[model samples]
Target chain A: AQSVTQLDSQVPVFEEAPVELRCNYSSSVSVYLFWYVQYPNQGLQLLLKYLSGSTLVESINGFEAEFNKSQTSFHLRKPSVHISDTAEYFCAVSDARGGGSNYKLTFGKGTLLTVNP
Target chain B: DAGVTQSPTHLIKTRGQQVTLRCSPKSGHDTVSWYQQALGQGPQFIFQYYEEEERQRGNFPDRFSGHQFPNYSSELNVNALLLGDSALYLCASSLGGSGNTIYFGEGSWLTVV
Candidate 1:
């Protein structure tokens, strides 16, 4: 079984300030990490993912997450925040079992990020 | 191209009743997965369908069932629903392969009363 832990349940930040959302995971096998954001009354949107080759992955919207194997962490970071960035963020992991089950994402409880102007 | 889409944006059901939610995968995608996101919780995988077959399942009980048609559209059915069954049902689609990016629909809100 694989599990993801998002350390914070809610994060408040002022616009243009830096923010980080911490996530940690436990898995028996190699894992793929992902970050998903959900706005109010909407579904999840993939922000970025870490499959291979690089430990750091970035999203088009200026968010980035670094996958740390030693610490079992995949913390998301953004240098500046915007009110539009306010949303609930989730951390997910899938084992390297591959095949049909590779898409079975195990998600974290989610962290609600509220950006203030 | 259209992304994943789900029907019955919101609905209310009584205990012991049955509910069926539908989904249409993104264009050209062949695999579909169902997830249940309870209030204030992360979405939990319910099952996945590929090639019109149940390719994988999660820890959910048999009360939660699903089907995929030749067109790659799918339905999620829950029988004998309980208050705990209230959740946001999410449908995700992706090509049947490892590392392929999966896309999610806006989701159907189910309120069990």
Candidate 2:
């Protein structure tokens, strides 16, 4: 079975400040990790993904995450955030378990990031 | 092209009633997946349909059923809906395989009054 845990429910940062969102996962087998962002009343957009190869991956919008195998973590970070970055972020893991649903994703509770000017 | 489209953007039903939600996948997408998002929670995978067959299912009850047509469109049917079922139902479309990035729709909000 695979499960995701997001330690923070909400994070507030001033504009142009650095931000970090923590995520951890538990899976008996190899897994694929991802971070998604959902703006107000909008569908989710992919932030980044860690499938294989480099443990560190980045999104074009200046967000990056490192896939720590030993720690079972994929924490999202941005050196500087803008007010437009305020949104709900989700961390997910996929593994071969359960049936169809679980086989796709085991998402965390989601973290709300609020960037203030 | 539209990323993904769900019908009846918002619906209101009562307990013990039934509701059917519809979805049309993005162009070139062969797989459609359904998810349930309660207030302040991440989207929970409900099921996945591929090749007009149910290729995956979640921890939902039997009351939660679905269908897939040859055109790759899909519908989610819920019987004996409960108040707890009041939430946003999202439809996501991916490529022909499982565990893909999966693009999501704006979602259909179902309020059980």
What DockQ, on C-alphas, does every prediction get? 0.67, 0.49
lDDT (10s digit) by residue, model 1, range B1-113: 88999999999999999999999999999999999999999999999998999988999999999999999999999999999999999999998778888899999999999
Question: Which tens-of-lDDT digit does each residue in A68-92 have in candidate 1?
Answer: 9999999999999999999999999
Which structure among the candidates has the greatest TM-score? 1
Off by over 4 Å in 1: A99-102
- Cα lDDT tens digits, model 2, B10-105, are 999989999999999988888888999999999898998888988889999999999989889999999999999998999988885544567889
Candidate 2 per-residue lDDT over residues A1-117, each given as its tens digit:
788999999999999999999999998888889999999988788889887789999999999999999999999999999999999999988873332322467789999999998
TM-score of chain A of 1: 0.96
RMSD of 2: 2.2
Model 2, TM vs. native: 0.95
Q: List the residue pairs that clash in candidate 1.
A: none
After superposition on all CA atoms, what RMSD does each candidate show versus the true structure?
1.0, 2.2
Q: Could you tell me how far off, in angstroms, the CA of residue A47 lies in candidate 1 after the best superposition? A: 0.3
